[model samples]
Target: MKLGIDRGSLVAWDPDGEEWVVVGEPWNHDLPAFLADGEEAVRKAERTFTNPERVSGRAPSGLPFTPASLRAFALWESHMINGAKGMVAAFGSPGVRRLVRGFEAVTGRVPPPLRPRANYYREPQFYMGNHRSVLPDEAEVAWPSFAQVLDFELELGVVIAREARDCTPAEGLAAIGGFVVMNDWTARDLQWDDTRRGTFGGVVKAKTFAGAMSAVVVTADEVLPRWRELTGRVLVNGEVWAQSSTASPLHDLGAAVAYAARGESVGPGEVLSSGTLPGCCGLEMRRFPRPGDEVRLELELGAGKPVTVTNTLGARPRRATQARHTEVARRK
Candidate 1:
């Protein structure tokens, strides 16, 4: 069933009627609490909406709930491999680009090292994201001032229903409360530098500045089993940019969550993303979103309505004057 916050109240979406029905009392905008209640919340939404406690016209949708924590895992090997090639094409130094092109021209494939590491098959690997920076669907997303090449990644976010620690994969799967379409906004230029030079190995400024999630969420019961059959598309300024699917991943979200819960706890309302879908990122497509572009991510899961997350890119900020490191060193 479709669930979200509408007009400051928890509501269930009726696709056929195109209306929002207020869920019963005690289920306010507290989505984490609702999810912590587990199956009871679903039953309440299902039953309460049956009689129509209160109905309202379509209003601006709000985030179902702010995530308690956010973790993104890179699961698709093809996205990684192709994304590497696209990076080399877009940001690699001239000599490196020539070498890569020559290597591809001769071998007809990206170098073996560029492929997903064998350890990726052995376990789930991920980076923590700034949960507080998440933007709602249809919200205006601004590029971070320091970045020039902004990009978006179409991904699936799994909402954790309850606290899990040292759990089995099945238990981890059971912990999923719902799923939401996710757009992981990236600063490609900053990411390139951070990836190679930053003391911290993985993405930092490139990813954590901002992200977007669908205003509505589909219950896990309705999505889990059929998730692999789902397909997705990315559109930039109303034009289709790429097509994708959830068909293959070295590790399912359940495994990723299970691995995450090895020692630390993965709590309710924490969002764990399935990383970028194969070919679903501008980084893989060789075209990035510019300011004023409307980037929309749509997922066809056979749900009543196709889940979509749309955000309009905002203009880059003007640079401000600042003292250089060299000047500071000289003064010291």
Candidate 2:
């Protein structure tokens, strides 16, 4: 069943009626609370919504939940390799330069011009994002003044159903509650700067702004049949920039979940993303978003309805100190 939040209440879609039926009140509990009860909770909710006292006048298309934490993984080998090469070229790190040359000499294959550290290829790499920064589709994303290059990453995300730790691949697969399309907005300039500084903190700053997600979360059971062959597209101002099948993911959902759950508990309402699909980001295409640009992402889950998310870029906000200085100068 599709789940969503509307008017601060938990609601489920009644496909036959084409409206959102309230099943639980937010004042009493949230989606996480229901999730803690697992499949039985979902079944009970489905039954309760069948004859609810109130139904939304229209279909619910709000965020399913604000994740407690959002962990995004680099599951596309191409994206990770190419991104590392681009970063090494842009930043010119001495150690990386020597490493790339040594790798090319030993392997007899032209290594990525700037081979990333060995750990990147040894296992999955992921970073935590600010969950509070997540926004629903159609929200206006602010273009931070600190950045010059804005880009969008099209991804597939899963919400955890229960707390998980030290889970095997099969167990991790079962931990997933639902799926959502994700548009991870990025500031390339800031990201590169942070990378160059060797701190990697810039990744957090670049990624934290306005991560857009689909309005409803489609249950995992509904998507499992066609999970490997799912297709996705990235559109900028209605123009398609990239399209690729998710079948090429280097680390599938099960592996990604297992990696995240290793020695650390991932709780309900937390989001885990299967990073950017191959050729699905502006960075790979060498094109970036401008002010007032609209980025739309769609993922075909074969569930009769594909998940889509859209966000429009707003003009960069003026720095508070600069705005105050300008006001004082104008007054004088």
Per model, state how many residue pairs clash. Answer: 0, 0
Candidate 1 per-residue lDDT, tens place, 195-265, comes to: 66789944887799899999888788778988887899998889999998999887877899899999989
On a 0 to 100 scale, what is the lDDT of residue 1 in model 2? 70
Residue pairs in clash, model 1: none
The top-ranked prediction according to lDDT is 1
Off by over 4 Å in 2: 25-29, 35-57, 84-110, 113-116, 317-332
Alpha-carbon local distance difference test for all models: 0.80, 0.74
Q: Estimate each model's TM-score.
A: 0.91, 0.82
Model 2, C-alpha of 139: deviation from truth (Å): 1.1
Clashing pairs in 2: none
After aligning candidate 2 to the native by TM-score, how far in Å is the CA of 158 from where it should be? Answer: 1.2
